[model samples]
Target: GESVGLHLPTLSVQEGDNSIINCAYSNSASDYFIWYKQESGKGPQFIIDIRSNMDKRQGQRVTVLLNKTVKHLSLQIAATQPGDSAVYFCAERPGNMLTFGGGTRLMVKP
Candidate 1:
Protein backbone atom coordinates (compact mmCIF):
# COMPACT_ATOMS: atom_id res chain seq x y z
CA GLY A 1 0.00 0.00 0.00
CA GLU A 2 1.05 3.58 -0.56
CA SER A 3 2.03 5.70 2.40
CA VAL A 4 -0.37 8.45 3.43
CA GLY A 5 1.19 10.55 6.18
CA LEU A 6 4.48 11.36 7.95
CA HIS A 7 5.72 12.85 11.19
CA LEU A 8 8.67 13.43 13.60
CA PRO A 9 7.76 13.64 17.27
CA THR A 10 10.80 15.15 18.97
CA LEU A 11 14.05 17.17 18.71
CA SER A 12 16.64 18.61 21.06
CA VAL A 13 19.25 21.38 20.91
CA GLN A 14 21.60 23.32 23.08
CA GLU A 15 21.50 27.03 23.68
CA GLY A 16 23.64 29.06 21.27
CA ASP A 17 23.67 26.17 18.84
CA ASN A 18 21.81 25.50 15.65
CA SER A 19 18.79 23.22 15.38
CA ILE A 20 17.30 21.40 12.44
CA ILE A 21 13.83 19.90 12.49
CA ASN A 22 12.55 17.82 9.62
CA CYS A 23 9.22 16.62 8.24
CA ALA A 24 8.06 14.43 5.39
CA TYR A 25 4.82 15.32 3.68
CA SER A 26 2.68 12.80 1.82
CA ASN A 27 0.97 15.04 -0.70
CA SER A 28 2.76 15.62 -3.97
CA ALA A 29 0.18 18.18 -4.99
CA SER A 30 0.69 20.40 -2.01
CA ASP A 31 1.66 23.89 -3.10
CA TYR A 32 2.19 25.62 0.18
CA PHE A 33 4.08 24.68 3.30
CA ILE A 34 4.31 26.43 6.64
CA TRP A 35 6.41 25.93 9.75
CA TYR A 36 4.87 26.81 13.08
CA LYS A 37 6.10 27.03 16.66
CA GLN A 38 3.86 26.44 19.66
CA GLU A 39 4.95 27.22 23.18
CA SER A 40 3.68 25.26 26.14
CA GLY A 41 0.29 26.95 26.37
CA LYS A 42 0.18 29.19 23.35
CA GLY A 43 -1.32 28.68 19.92
CA PRO A 44 0.86 27.72 17.02
CA GLN A 45 2.68 30.73 15.59
CA PHE A 46 3.96 31.06 12.07
CA ILE A 47 7.72 30.63 11.81
CA ILE A 48 8.34 30.50 8.09
CA ASP A 49 6.94 29.17 4.82
CA ILE A 50 7.90 28.08 1.33
CA ARG A 51 5.87 27.76 -1.82
CA SER A 52 6.15 24.71 -4.00
CA ASN A 53 7.85 26.78 -6.64
CA MET A 54 10.64 27.69 -4.26
CA ASP A 55 13.22 25.40 -2.75
CA LYS A 56 14.14 27.54 0.21
CA ARG A 57 13.02 30.56 2.22
CA GLN A 58 14.55 32.44 5.10
CA GLY A 59 13.41 34.65 7.96
CA GLN A 60 15.03 36.22 10.97
CA ARG A 61 17.14 33.50 12.55
CA VAL A 62 15.09 30.86 10.75
CA THR A 63 15.21 29.08 7.41
CA VAL A 64 12.82 26.66 5.69
CA LEU A 65 13.88 24.30 2.97
CA LEU A 66 11.58 22.25 0.80
CA ASN A 67 12.66 19.27 -1.25
CA LYS A 68 9.78 18.36 -3.55
CA THR A 69 11.72 15.48 -5.03
CA VAL A 70 11.77 13.68 -1.69
CA LYS A 71 8.57 15.17 -0.27
CA HIS A 72 10.60 16.52 2.61
CA LEU A 73 10.90 19.81 4.45
CA SER A 74 13.23 21.11 7.12
CA LEU A 75 13.40 24.06 9.45
CA GLN A 76 16.76 25.42 10.61
CA ILE A 77 17.16 27.77 13.50
CA ALA A 78 20.33 29.75 14.12
CA ALA A 79 21.56 30.43 17.61
CA THR A 80 18.97 28.34 19.38
CA GLN A 81 17.91 29.86 22.65
CA PRO A 82 15.92 28.91 25.72
CA GLY A 83 12.91 30.84 24.53
CA ASP A 84 13.19 29.06 21.22
CA SER A 85 12.37 25.80 22.94
CA ALA A 86 8.93 24.74 21.77
CA VAL A 87 6.95 22.24 19.79
CA TYR A 88 7.28 22.85 16.07
CA PHE A 89 5.04 21.61 13.32
CA CYS A 90 4.95 21.61 9.55
CA ALA A 91 1.67 22.06 7.72
CA GLU A 92 1.01 21.31 4.10
CA ARG A 93 -1.75 22.85 2.02
CA PRO A 94 -2.85 20.37 -0.60
CA GLY A 95 -5.84 22.41 -1.71
CA ASN A 96 -8.05 24.29 0.70
CA MET A 97 -7.23 22.44 3.89
CA LEU A 98 -3.94 22.14 5.73
CA THR A 99 -2.54 18.85 6.98
CA PHE A 100 -0.22 19.13 9.94
CA GLY A 101 2.61 16.82 10.95
CA GLY A 102 2.98 15.30 14.41
CA GLY A 103 5.26 18.08 15.60
CA THR A 104 8.81 17.98 17.01
CA ARG A 105 9.64 19.13 20.48
CA LEU A 106 12.66 21.48 20.44
CA MET A 107 14.55 21.19 23.68
CA VAL A 108 17.08 23.90 24.28
CA LYS A 109 19.65 23.03 26.86
CA PRO A 110 21.56 25.70 28.70
Candidate 2:
Protein backbone atom coordinates (compact mmCIF):
# COMPACT_ATOMS: atom_id res chain seq x y z
CA GLY A 1 0.00 0.00 0.00
CA GLU A 2 1.18 3.48 -0.93
CA SER A 3 0.56 6.69 0.92
CA VAL A 4 -1.39 9.59 -0.54
CA GLY A 5 0.57 12.14 -2.54
CA LEU A 6 0.09 15.46 -4.35
CA HIS A 7 0.05 16.01 -8.08
CA LEU A 8 -0.94 18.46 -10.83
CA PRO A 9 -2.47 15.83 -13.20
CA THR A 10 -1.99 17.61 -16.53
CA LEU A 11 -0.57 20.56 -18.47
CA SER A 12 -0.96 21.71 -22.06
CA VAL A 13 1.37 23.88 -24.08
CA GLN A 14 1.78 25.05 -27.63
CA GLU A 15 4.57 23.79 -29.78
CA GLY A 16 7.70 25.95 -29.74
CA ASP A 17 6.53 27.48 -26.50
CA ASN A 18 8.05 26.92 -23.11
CA SER A 19 6.49 24.67 -20.51
CA ILE A 20 6.75 24.86 -16.76
CA ILE A 21 5.89 21.95 -14.47
CA ASN A 22 5.72 22.30 -10.72
CA CYS A 23 5.92 19.77 -7.86
CA ALA A 24 5.81 19.76 -4.06
CA TYR A 25 7.58 17.36 -1.75
CA SER A 26 6.96 16.43 1.87
CA ASN A 27 10.30 15.17 3.15
CA SER A 28 12.43 17.90 4.63
CA ALA A 29 15.34 15.50 4.91
CA SER A 30 15.52 14.74 1.20
CA ASP A 31 18.88 15.69 -0.29
CA TYR A 32 18.54 14.62 -3.94
CA PHE A 33 15.78 15.40 -6.43
CA ILE A 34 15.27 14.20 -9.97
CA TRP A 35 12.86 14.99 -12.78
CA TYR A 36 11.73 12.32 -15.23
CA LYS A 37 9.69 12.19 -18.42
CA GLN A 38 7.60 9.14 -19.26
CA GLU A 39 6.14 8.48 -22.65
CA SER A 40 3.14 6.30 -23.25
CA GLY A 41 3.95 2.65 -22.49
CA LYS A 42 7.47 3.59 -21.51
CA GLY A 43 9.34 3.91 -18.27
CA PRO A 44 10.18 7.27 -16.74
CA GLN A 45 13.30 8.63 -18.36
CA PHE A 46 15.73 10.97 -16.66
CA ILE A 47 15.38 14.63 -17.50
CA ILE A 48 17.29 16.62 -14.94
CA ASP A 49 18.27 16.60 -11.30
CA ILE A 50 19.28 18.91 -8.48
CA ARG A 51 20.71 18.56 -5.02
CA SER A 52 19.46 20.06 -1.75
CA ASN A 53 22.59 22.22 -1.64
CA MET A 54 21.81 23.76 -5.04
CA ASP A 55 18.93 26.01 -5.91
CA LYS A 56 18.94 25.26 -9.60
CA ARG A 57 20.40 23.05 -12.33
CA GLN A 58 20.06 22.85 -16.10
CA GLY A 59 20.25 20.15 -18.77
CA GLN A 60 20.06 20.08 -22.54
CA ARG A 61 16.63 21.66 -22.98
CA VAL A 62 15.40 21.32 -19.46
CA THR A 63 15.97 23.14 -16.20
CA VAL A 64 15.19 21.97 -12.67
CA LEU A 65 14.77 24.34 -9.75
CA LEU A 66 14.56 23.29 -6.14
CA ASN A 67 13.26 25.40 -3.29
CA LYS A 68 13.93 23.51 -0.11
CA THR A 69 12.56 26.38 1.92
CA VAL A 70 9.06 25.67 0.64
CA LYS A 71 9.60 22.01 -0.22
CA HIS A 72 8.83 22.79 -3.85
CA LEU A 73 10.39 21.81 -7.15
CA SER A 74 9.83 22.90 -10.73
CA LEU A 75 10.92 21.96 -14.23
CA GLN A 76 11.13 24.26 -17.24
CA ILE A 77 11.22 23.05 -20.81
CA ALA A 78 12.32 25.22 -23.69
CA ALA A 79 10.69 25.04 -27.14
CA THR A 80 8.06 22.51 -26.29
CA GLN A 81 7.58 20.00 -29.05
CA PRO A 82 5.20 17.18 -29.86
CA GLY A 83 8.01 14.79 -29.12
CA ASP A 84 8.20 16.30 -25.69
CA SER A 85 4.66 15.30 -24.90
CA ALA A 86 4.74 12.95 -21.92
CA VAL A 87 4.13 12.61 -18.24
CA TYR A 88 6.67 14.40 -16.09
CA PHE A 89 7.33 13.34 -12.53
CA CYS A 90 9.47 14.57 -9.68
CA ALA A 91 11.24 12.25 -7.28
CA GLU A 92 12.81 12.90 -3.93
CA ARG A 93 15.54 10.67 -2.54
CA PRO A 94 15.29 10.44 1.20
CA GLY A 95 17.86 8.10 2.67
CA ASN A 96 18.11 5.15 0.24
CA MET A 97 14.50 5.12 -0.97
CA LEU A 98 12.84 7.34 -3.56
CA THR A 99 9.36 8.78 -3.44
CA PHE A 100 7.70 9.96 -6.62
CA GLY A 101 5.08 12.55 -7.36
CA GLY A 102 1.84 11.66 -9.15
CA GLY A 103 3.04 13.37 -12.32
CA THR A 104 2.03 16.06 -14.80
CA ARG A 105 1.06 15.26 -18.35
CA LEU A 106 2.57 17.69 -20.86
CA MET A 107 0.66 18.02 -24.11
CA VAL A 108 2.27 19.97 -26.88
CA LYS A 109 -0.16 21.18 -29.50
CA PRO A 110 1.39 21.40 -32.91
Candidate 3:
Protein backbone atom coordinates (compact mmCIF):
# COMPACT_ATOMS: atom_id res chain seq x y z
CA GLY A 1 0.00 0.00 0.00
CA GLU A 2 1.03 3.59 -0.65
CA SER A 3 0.63 6.58 1.65
CA VAL A 4 0.91 10.34 1.28
CA GLY A 5 0.56 13.29 3.62
CA LEU A 6 1.17 16.99 4.01
CA HIS A 7 3.65 18.63 6.31
CA LEU A 8 1.24 21.29 7.47
CA PRO A 9 -2.45 20.89 8.09
CA THR A 10 -3.27 24.56 7.43
CA LEU A 11 -1.76 27.57 5.76
CA SER A 12 -2.88 31.20 5.85
CA VAL A 13 -1.86 33.62 3.17
CA GLN A 14 -2.77 37.23 2.50
CA GLU A 15 -4.90 37.91 -0.53
CA GLY A 16 -2.83 38.42 -3.68
CA ASP A 17 0.15 36.59 -2.24
CA ASN A 18 1.55 33.28 -3.32
CA SER A 19 0.82 30.01 -1.57
CA ILE A 20 2.83 26.81 -1.54
CA ILE A 21 1.41 23.50 -0.40
CA ASN A 22 3.73 20.61 0.33
CA CYS A 23 3.19 16.87 0.28
CA ALA A 24 5.31 13.83 0.99
CA TYR A 25 4.70 10.39 -0.44
CA SER A 26 6.04 7.03 0.57
CA ASN A 27 6.01 5.44 -2.84
CA SER A 28 9.02 6.39 -4.90
CA ALA A 29 7.88 4.42 -7.91
CA SER A 30 4.66 6.29 -8.50
CA ASP A 31 4.35 7.15 -12.15
CA TYR A 32 2.26 10.30 -11.90
CA PHE A 33 1.23 12.76 -9.25
CA ILE A 34 -1.65 15.21 -9.39
CA TRP A 35 -2.54 18.23 -7.40
CA TYR A 36 -6.19 18.69 -6.56
CA LYS A 37 -8.17 21.48 -4.99
CA GLN A 38 -11.22 20.52 -2.96
CA GLU A 39 -13.76 23.10 -2.02
CA SER A 40 -16.39 22.65 0.62
CA GLY A 41 -18.96 19.98 -0.21
CA LYS A 42 -17.35 19.38 -3.57
CA GLY A 43 -15.05 16.74 -4.95
CA PRO A 44 -11.45 17.53 -5.68
CA GLN A 45 -10.68 19.33 -8.92
CA PHE A 46 -7.48 19.05 -10.90
CA ILE A 47 -5.17 21.99 -10.49
CA ILE A 48 -1.89 20.81 -11.98
CA ASP A 49 0.20 17.68 -12.33
CA ILE A 50 3.79 16.53 -12.74
CA ARG A 51 5.24 13.30 -13.96
CA SER A 52 8.00 11.35 -12.24
CA ASN A 53 10.37 12.16 -15.07
CA MET A 54 9.84 15.90 -14.85
CA ASP A 55 11.01 18.08 -12.01
CA LYS A 56 8.43 20.79 -12.52
CA ARG A 57 5.35 21.71 -14.52
CA GLN A 58 3.42 24.94 -14.71
CA GLY A 59 -0.15 25.84 -15.53
CA GLN A 60 -1.98 29.15 -15.89
CA ARG A 61 -1.34 30.39 -12.37
CA VAL A 62 -0.14 27.27 -10.66
CA THR A 63 2.91 25.02 -10.66
CA VAL A 64 3.65 21.44 -9.62
CA LEU A 65 7.00 20.12 -8.58
CA LEU A 66 8.27 16.64 -7.92
CA ASN A 67 11.38 15.49 -6.12
CA LYS A 68 11.90 11.83 -6.50
CA THR A 69 14.99 11.81 -4.33
CA VAL A 70 13.02 12.92 -1.31
CA LYS A 71 9.66 11.67 -2.43
CA HIS A 72 8.23 15.16 -2.09
CA LEU A 73 5.75 17.10 -4.18
CA SER A 74 4.42 20.60 -4.05
CA LEU A 75 1.81 22.89 -5.53
CA GLN A 76 2.35 26.60 -5.84
CA ILE A 77 -0.49 29.03 -6.46
CA ALA A 78 0.17 32.59 -7.53
CA ALA A 79 -1.76 35.67 -6.44
CA THR A 80 -3.83 33.87 -3.90
CA GLN A 81 -7.46 34.91 -3.74
CA PRO A 82 -10.40 34.11 -1.53
CA GLY A 83 -11.64 31.83 -4.24
CA ASP A 84 -8.40 29.90 -3.98
CA SER A 85 -9.16 28.90 -0.44
CA ALA A 86 -9.61 25.16 -0.27
CA VAL A 87 -8.18 21.88 0.92
CA TYR A 88 -5.33 20.98 -1.36
CA PHE A 89 -4.03 17.45 -1.74
CA CYS A 90 -2.56 15.00 -4.19
CA ALA A 91 -3.29 11.65 -5.77
CA GLU A 92 -0.47 9.39 -6.83
CA ARG A 93 -0.47 6.12 -8.68
CA PRO A 94 2.21 3.74 -7.57
CA GLY A 95 0.46 0.81 -9.14
CA ASN A 96 -3.02 0.23 -10.50
CA MET A 97 -4.90 2.16 -7.84
CA LEU A 98 -4.85 5.80 -6.91
CA THR A 99 -3.64 6.75 -3.45
CA PHE A 100 -4.84 10.08 -2.09
CA GLY A 101 -2.90 12.21 0.38
CA GLY A 102 -4.07 14.05 3.44
CA GLY A 103 -5.12 17.63 2.69
CA THR A 104 -3.65 20.95 3.68
CA ARG A 105 -6.20 23.72 4.00
CA LEU A 106 -5.36 27.02 2.34
CA MET A 107 -6.95 30.16 3.75
CA VAL A 108 -6.73 33.50 2.02
CA LYS A 109 -7.17 36.61 4.11
CA PRO A 110 -8.06 39.97 2.75
Top TM-score model: 3
Candidate 2 is scored at a TM of 0.93
Look at candidate 2 and tell me the lDDT of residue 41: 98
Q: Relative to the unseen true structure, what is the C-alpha lDDT of residue 83 in candidate 3, on a scale of 0 to 100?
A: 97
lDDT of 2 at 28: 82
Give the TM-score of each candidate: 0.92, 0.93, 0.96
Q: Write the per-residue lDDT of candidate 3 for residues 13-107, one digit (tens) a residue.
A: 99999999999999877899999999999999988888899999999999998989899999999999999999998889887877888899999
Give the winner by lDDT: 2 or 3. Answer: 3
Give the runs in model 3 whose Cα sits over 4 Å from its true position. Answer: none
Q: What is the C-alpha lDDT of each candidate?
A: 0.87, 0.87, 0.91
C-alpha RMSD in Å of predicted model 2 compared with the true structure: 2.0
What are the per-residue Cα lDDT tens digits for candidate 2 across 1-110? Answer: 33214457889899999999999888888889998899999999988889999999989889999888878899999999899999998888888987898889999998
User: Candidate 2: lDDT over CA atoms?
Assistant: 0.87
